[model samples]
Target: MPRQFPKLNFSEVDENVRLLAEKVFAKVLREEDSKDALSLFTVPEDCPIGQKEAKERELQKELAEQQSVETAKRKKSFKMIRSQSLSLQIPTQEWKAPSVNPVLSPATPVLPSAFLPVQVPYDVPEFQRVSISGDYCAGVTVDDYEQAAKSLVKALLIREKYSRLAYHRFPRTTSQYLCSMRDEKWKVEDEVYPDFHSPPEENEDPYNLDDAPDNLDYVIKIKGGIPFVYDNKEMMELNEPRSLPYPDLETYTLDLSHVLALIADGPTKTYCHRRLNFLESKFSLHEMLNEMSEFKELKSNPHRDFYNVRKVDTHIHAAACMNQKHLLRFIKHTYQTEPHRIVAEKKGKKMTLKQVFESLHMDPYDLTVDSLDVHAGRQTFHRFDKFNSKYNPVGASELRDLYLKTENYIGGEYFARMVKEVACELEESKYQYTEPRLSIYGRSPDEWQNLAKWFIKHKVYSPNMRWIIQVPRIYDIFRSKNILPSFGKMLENIFVPLFEATINPKEHKELHLFLKYVTGFDSVDDESKHSGHMFSDKSLNPDLWTSEKNPPYSYYLYYMYVNIMLLNNLRRERGMCTFLFRPHCGEAGSITHLVSAFLTADNISHGLLLKKSPVLQYLYYLAQIPIAMSPLSNNSLFLEYSKNPLREFLHKGLHVSLSTDDPMQFHYTKEALMEEYAIAAQVWKLSTCDLCEIARNSVLQSGLSDKEKQKFLGVNYCKEGPEGNDIRKTNVAQIRMAFRYETLCNELSFLADAMKTEQISALSK
Candidate 1:
């Protein structure tokens, strides 16, 4: 036989039975152990222990599974919430379920992938195309139809009952009958009942007495297959667009409360359309419509030919009253055509009106004397205000913000210099002082103090030496802040010695000693050109010095001349120099000499006009002429000198192409000197190449080196100088130089022929 199935032991037969026994036993034990235990549900004390234990274990397993499922679901929900929150905060993250092993329950519902609120599309034709009548209903359902029918019924009932009419008395019983019949069936039930439908056969027939209501002569058709009665034909016709329910006033006053209620409860656009329609019906809205149209046009891109538009009352009002372009154009047109109509000077008038009107081709007479008088009363001015009164007020905080924002846009050095210059200007204006002579031309003490303070406050680090020099003069009082010791020392050391050298040697003997000490020169000795003394012997041979006799002039003159030469040389040597040594200073000197010459030539012996030395007088004229071709023989001493003495005097601060030999040693009358110089140049009409070489040599001989001298020579001094002086000097110089070089020998040959015989008699004498 096959192995028999395991015999069922009745003592351990059912597992569920065993668990239930154990649960009963446990409950009984628990109730015995504690007073607050669930006594009502306790099992007997004799329940099987094995059975109770099995039941407790089974129940605990079920509870743990439930809690696990709940916790997992909660965690999933938290992850979804976190993902949603993170999406809002950082929009890049995609939302997803958090769990790797999500066990979906049968009861749990799935969510949609995305959510968005619903909205009605407004661009549909029906939405934009507003109609005046209820006959045209957009997107209305059956409910809308029922409501319109009810309103019509109500309006008819009110109309018929209020007025004494036989049809009205028949209406209540008839209406009830009709309602009952309608409730029963849509079609008429009574055999005697009239059909509730349109008069299909009659298209334009006159209304019948029965079809109309009491006292109403005409009826208007509505959208819901209903009709309204009006006392007057005009009222019915006027209500044709809107299908107004109660158009007959004498029969019964129309209750517009329903219309208002509909509007209050309707869509905003719907209400707006109806309101607009009402206004149009009540008033002449043409002007308002035009204004609206103009507003739209003005807000769009501007039209160049804005004046090409229709003009009427609305246009005139817009032109006169509005600030918009269309209005301005209209006003301008009106002013041009009917100037007298423009009451420009009225209290209500503004300058914009005046401006617009004046800009047009209007007749002035039309603008009326009254308008002119009005404008005169207001003190109208031609100049427009640079700043607008509305936007550019002084107290506006936006102005300060703008200034702060734009502060960086201004270059740092420029701002500092501007402030310093403004301070100087203020001081100068207050004192009314001229330049150079600080005592005579400088500011008063108080002004100086203020200026110094101002400069100190505004000063910043500067790379320029000229600005560096100005700082001390403007900010002396605030030395700690404004003056840098190193820069101040440089100025003091260089300028003091240089200045002392030029001091009156007779008055300041110590200055003379200081110059010698500073420059390491020997003591100076007295010498005179008349006594056959050369400047070389009298003073240690200085740089740029020649063995030629010293011209009869003051030592100060010689000193200044030397200093100028020194400055010029230093500028040539230094790569970068300030704009200080310019034609202004050089030309100023020339002007000084020329003015003196002019005064002396005119025999005006004013102390200021009379120049002490004939040498300076000659030099002044020489400054006006070419220095290299000077009759006084241009040899080793004058070689490379190209600067014209006449040009120098006429202009100023001209770079010497070895031209600044000695300002003091120059002596000769400008005219006589020019005459002699012209004789030589005319006699030696050299070739263009040779004359160019002479010019180049003169420029090269200037205090500037080859490169710098070339620059100064390249720039036409006569042209670069002041106005009224020769700016075309380059062309003239080129022409003169070329003529001299091209025909020097030829001109010399002709000179003998040109010479008069009278000169031979003088030679014989």
Candidate 2:
């Protein structure tokens, strides 16, 4: 009924209303006929339109929430942009080429007043070539001549000790008196089928008849230096070895000619003795008998060669050891010819057997254990046999004393400065012109290039003094990080142009010195070894240099050697080097820093000695220390193990320094490290004086100028007057309080006493 009513009104409606009504009518008609189209306007028949709209809203909300969650997640996950500063500018100029200044000649420093009026020992041209013994020829005594003669006699006696009586049985050459009697008597028989005719016996003199033989015998004697003659035969048995005496050899004036005949070509012990006897007889050379005293057991072999007091090029030390008197005699003789020559020239020519024997009797260089132990080598002379693996022991308390007495004068601050100076020397380096010129073991080429570029940029940004970076490698394998940039192709843009502009020819020496200083291979390992620079091209697995090429010019090595000797002596005197660790950082590392460092005294000293080019001295000194302390030959791993805490170095008498080997990398200025040491020692229960000694040793081991050394020894730092004792006393008291150790207190007392004595000595001087 409602649809019929709407259809009747559809055409009668106004235009706007009629269109609406017609649309309504058409919609009604379409809805009535089309069941599929009716559903467009209707929600699900089972649900209300409001409910459907609510569900649609819920769906829209869900979609919006999902998009919001995704948007939020994206925002949360995005990373922030980052920017870093890159320094780039003029390449490092330290490696730059030089330009000529206004002055064309090289600059020279004027001699200071102290160095002026220089006097060298002698000029090469004005020197004479006089013989060493020429001036002292009259110094010999009659006793010397007698001793020389006696030496020859002694040799003859020794030969006679082995002689035996020999009787040749022939048909009795001459039957003196033969009698034939019928009752009782003797009969004489003749040979050759003929009756033997005997000469009548002659009556003997009453004095000689008692001992005279029935047969004819003869005796002959000659004056001094003469030969002997025997019965009817010219048997002048010379005192020569096994062979018949020189034919017709007869002595005359104890001349060199007669002695030369016996000793000129023979290896007989008598050769040198005979020659010495002749010389003594002629020159009276016994007055020059100054020789080193040696114990019988410790005495060196007597066969050592000694030149006459006239030879040149004689080593002073050898002379001191073998025959100091002879050396002095020679020196006295040559004083006029080359008065200024510090040492005698060694003669390459050899001595005769007689000469060898003469020295053997005197053995001037032989050092007895007693003599050397007390007065020459350290009081404690320890000889280690490398062939034997026995390790000599040192007491802990003794080592502690040494640690307490080390040199602390350089202090932390000045020590840092010295390190800084050493590093500064490398600042002026440039890239090497050669390929692979840098170390393969140090910073790699990439690292260096980065550094170079960074350095240039840094300089441009905030130019100041150049960075004085120290490049000392800890081990041989750590040298791969020292490369410079190539032309702009790699290693950032900074290295190439910078290297091209700054590099020069003469700078190679500086580079080498710097590299050597950093790499710790400036010298050879030993004189016996060779440089074999060829090793530079191959893998660095072999020994690189010998001790000869890298001689120690500094006294640091000597000081270190002395320290080791001192430690050994102390151990023999007292007991050990130390018993506890100094202050430490944390609980992680071992508490053996002080002990390990103390043990390193030998190695450190060895390194220092290598600087001096005294391989013989080094070896000699090494022989004086225990083998356990030495890092010789191929025993590095052993040395390292001995240094380790796990190894428990039972033998502990060692003297060492806790040095700031490479302070820059440790982020410690020398002074700062020292301060830390002081703090740590307190925390770790270490002795104060022990720390002081470590500081002192650092200074003592330093290569400081003499004036600097004086300052470091506390000679100049203390008050000028005895009245200043108050301050020193107060300081000592404070240290005692802080350390609270009796040993430290005792060391301080000793130091005070030493200082007083030193001051007194200085005043007297």
Candidate 3:
């Protein structure tokens, strides 16, 4: 420093070293000279340093100053952007997209404001001809539904005392309820109060205990499916809301498995523990029934109730809620039928109700409220749907995580392996060509590209296999993550290529199914609403290709309507039929969304909620667009086990088929449909014959050729008996044969007791 460090040779040092040397030299100049400038550094006319060297230093100093200014500017801009973005009043989740420049840094860029969907001119021409006609359901009539309803009612009313049970949870909202209207209980409270007694006041009371009403035996007739209470007092009808009468638009299945989710761990495990408490009420059926009825003052709400059944044809329950013995059987069955099995894996353990109930709380030493306090426990179930909101709605953040984690594997070797697995499954099922369905809501262009490649490779071995895919936009905003791909890029870079590869010049039939999907538009918040796809030039925010925001499918309702209607003229030009599978469509059934789908739907998935919209249901029924319902998915998401709308759809004479949506995620077996059928069978209490018809509908609704469909159905139909010859039905019948046989034996025993009781009456006469 004393010698001025030989003028600090920064030029000889590397870029990083020179930067350090520059800082050191500047500090020395400030500390040593203070006010005096280092005249040697400047390019003076007489100085030893040349203008060339001085100019280079000056240029470097200018560059450094520019960088410092930019750094300060960027910091201020970032803070301002965040402040402004967070302050905005958006109805959905709070969001911000920083306006970052890629040239400056490799950071995230501000997402463009949601782009408006491109609207077509009124004179746009159509490209594809869409059609759905000439199917087995074409013969179904309203009269057929009425007859089926009648037969179903007759079957339900086979028991005299309880007669029937049905479920209807009206006031359907985000937070739902079971509303015992869907159980065997609905008959007593809402329809016929056979043992109803007007409560006693202290003054008007005799003993309050004796104030209980006497048994009132009433045989109610169900006409048009529902029994009108008008005869009790025809005058009350005028003031009351038009009553929804009952042949009870209800479907019973044995499996609550689809509808009821088991909380494995975490704090939410408390909900599962509470759910298990329902089992303790298995002891005193009458006491339990009272508890089930006591609390709720249903003065204004007359739609839910519990029924007393002397007969047990349809009362058998696996949850001990109905036929008490079912709880123990269901528990044992679940264990015995481990893994792929839904039947007994070994001989029964024969654990009695008392033994199991004791094991629940394990208070064998406690005296008061001992394990099965049927009286107290039943009260807990009165609001059976208390936890409806507990674990239902999946957080957007969670789905975003899935997208992020899923992206790395989507276009890699894992993709190949998944496709190979599908190939193997097709081979196992003995199908020449099989279509495995996938949704494009949370996917990137690479994912679809990878799929196309693997599919092409697979087609070498399986020529007949068809690749069917669905693309839909269920969310309006793009989450700030590198998981999802945007709508525009997907179409331009993904779907267009996939489709181009699929369509052949001579025959445009390489793609077996093209499902344009739209979902999540029926949101409560307007900000979160994404009714259609937003058309954006994704080229701007190019930090990630796979994380583009969701875009619309060619299947948005309004877009679909215009396209399909326009396509009608193209039928003569190209003899091609187009199909679309729009699912998660129950609530968003506008004339455009639902009615429009009639033109192109292969089948609609999760049309369970379609029952609410009568017009939509009728339209789909008229169009013969089969409803592919996944009971387990519905259970995990919505609808109580007893409140499954599949039965209602079937009763409406809707073309319906059983399906397993996201079976692996829902933890269903490889034969996912069977588990669905199992749950549907349990909660809806369906018979083997009904299951066969449902199973058959799946094949009927398939997008197979006539010959293929015929061959498939032919192999399924039973030749030996009145029932269908399908192996699935055969298996169900065998498992259920025990239940039916047991029912028959119990009925005989009851009949024998009745005969013995009546013998004295005949003698007295």
Candidate 4:
């Protein structure tokens, strides 16, 4: 007979059982019987005596055995959910058991392995994809969160739809739907190791600023300033710039060499196929593709001329870099640090850089912007938003339930710090500010309040820091709550209460009256605004809005206009300026939107859509509005001619500053800003002066206070008693000042070049 041990709470043992254990249990149940120390839950084998107890123990053993057999049976016949390879014939969808787990939220409890009977495979093509129709951006109410839930589910479903579609169309069209994979594998992307920055504490209160790490003093990359360069040989090699159609190293334009080296080993595992496809379009690859006819015989691996034929996107992370011949490896082995030097020497006969290129199956040609468009869909941006992903759908409701499960899973502090960390990285790179300033795009009031609380906490943690938190998706909250008519009321209700609850006047004197902190939406344009929920219905709301009558189809415009007015009113009443992003997409109310927003908003995000209207650019320049541009994000998503209009806008003198908009999605950081700056600089061949002006604009137009701005503008503030006058100087020395500014520019350029030389030398050493 199989022996079974029973666990017992000695204090609660049956009287008869207690009597039986009295002899030996005396040590466990002492005369001091104060606090029951018998929590170890052990039972004396010879103690308890009861037929009923023994029967119960036997019954439990039987039940456990039954479960074990059932689990074994289930495992023996598990069906495949994902196709490991992409082939001509499309795999059909199959039904599976519903997820018996509770809704997935940050707060949701983790389920035991036994509970998850179905071993759901990572995201693949056959799972029903989530799709939000054109109406998703229109509007919905919190009451309609279920409907909102469905739409959100759709958004989540399609998050990886591009991943699957990218591979479905084969090598020819695969690039269109492919996105960058964080890992080189076909499975779901794992979280990046050693997060860029530490996360925020769960309970947000009573924080100490001193506990935070000292922010390293940032110096511009110009001469006499500290050069911020990655010291790791691997980092330098992998990041050494190269492109498809491989441009000469001496060329000014960007190539994939650096980015690929940093992440990938060879041609097959770089960015999304779509990115490679975009690259192929940028360069005249006819000769190369034709020369590499042998590539057709090569299966799976990415030919430098083409891409991999997988339904899922793969990326080059620490894992992928472990294999293959990397051109950057020559640089790494010659320069890589002891940490990453563990990588084995090249497995086969090695070739030098030039020889490696000459040995490629094909010869590459020119790289130009002639037929390329940056506005095209970037299929690889899905790695950042994975909350709603739950595979193995049995039916529609279960899928909907799956989608609904991730509703509260929207990341808060982890995301918040990711932004902060990116800013920190930028601070070390080519950034001008001593402190990293960032602007966030948010949707709901709760998100706004939480951001506000986080900002205060961050301030309390590092008070001298400056952060511009803007909300572009504020309208969704109004629509979700069905308060379109009372949009102003909602802003007031959320912002004011949030301020009162989080802020301590006696403590944070710098932020005395914080109002109108967050601002914008998914794009409040005539066309897209009408996509989510109807903004009209004059009689639907009365006496709530200043304009009781909702004009036909202009809800997007009018709603933004009224909210701007109300937010401004709140600012005036409170007597302070708060961070606001007057974001308007497309040409709807284009001029009026710019004028009103510039007057009230401190800055504008992605306002480059006004490329069609030159007059707006003139007004934007005249108003001296700071336009925050996220180059990589826009480049990955929008068409070149329409995306940001780098040449025209900068030429017109809009106070332009480069920012990493949604860095995680774009894989950008402070240093990445330099990449975008490099792209703009190379494409337009922007002069060093232009780069200076752009850097100046970012510092001057930043959300720093006037006194702090003055402090920041002080030329030799970082040095001890160095000779330099105030930038605002106006005397006989003004002429000298002009020469100094010119000198400063020269110094900066020299320093940048020297930094590069110094870094390379340091590593080469």
lDDT of 1 by residue, 446-475 (tens): 322232232234442111101111111211
**Order of quality (lDDT):** 3, 4, 1, 2
Q: How many residue pairs clash in each candidate?
A: 43, 64, 38, 41
lDDT per residue as tens, model 4, 65-124: 435644323222211101111111122344353354211111101111111222322211
In candidate 3 the C-alpha lDDT for residue 262 amounts to 11
- Let me know the TM-score candidate 3 reaches against the reference structure: 0.35
Alpha-carbon shift of residue 740 in model 2 (angstroms): 21
Each model's lDDT: 0.24, 0.21, 0.30, 0.30
Residue 357 of model 3 has an lDDT of 30
* lDDT of candidate 3 at residue 539, scale 0 to 100: 23
Q: Which of candidates 2 and 3 is the stronger one according to lDDT?
A: 3
Model 4 accuracy (lDDT, Cα): 0.30
Candidate 3, RMSD to the unseen true structure:
36.9
Quote each prediction's TM-score.
0.17, 0.19, 0.35, 0.36
Comparison by TM-score, 3 against 4, better one: 4
Span of ten consecutive residues with least summed lDDT in model 2: 80-89
Lowest lDDT block of 10, candidate 1: 310-319
lDDT of 2 by residue, 1-765 (tens): 010101112122223432442343344334334444212222222222126665566456545644664433322221110000001101111222324311121111111111112122110111111112221212222223223323333222211111100000111101110110011232222211101111112462211213211222222222211222244334435422111121111111111121222221112222232222232232222112211111110122232111100011100010011122222233233333543322211165343322432433533234332222211112111211221111100112211111111111211222222223322322222100000011111233243433333222222111101111211212222222223211111111212221211122122222211211111111111211112221111212112211222211111111122222222222212221110101111011111111121222222222222111121111112111111111111122111212221111111112233322212112122232343344435543434333443333333322222343343343422211111112121111111111112111111121122222223333334
Task: Tell me the spans in candidate 2 whose CA falls farther than 4 Å from its real position.
Answer: 1-653, 660-671, 705-707, 714-765
- Two-way lDDT contest, 2 vs 4, winner: 4
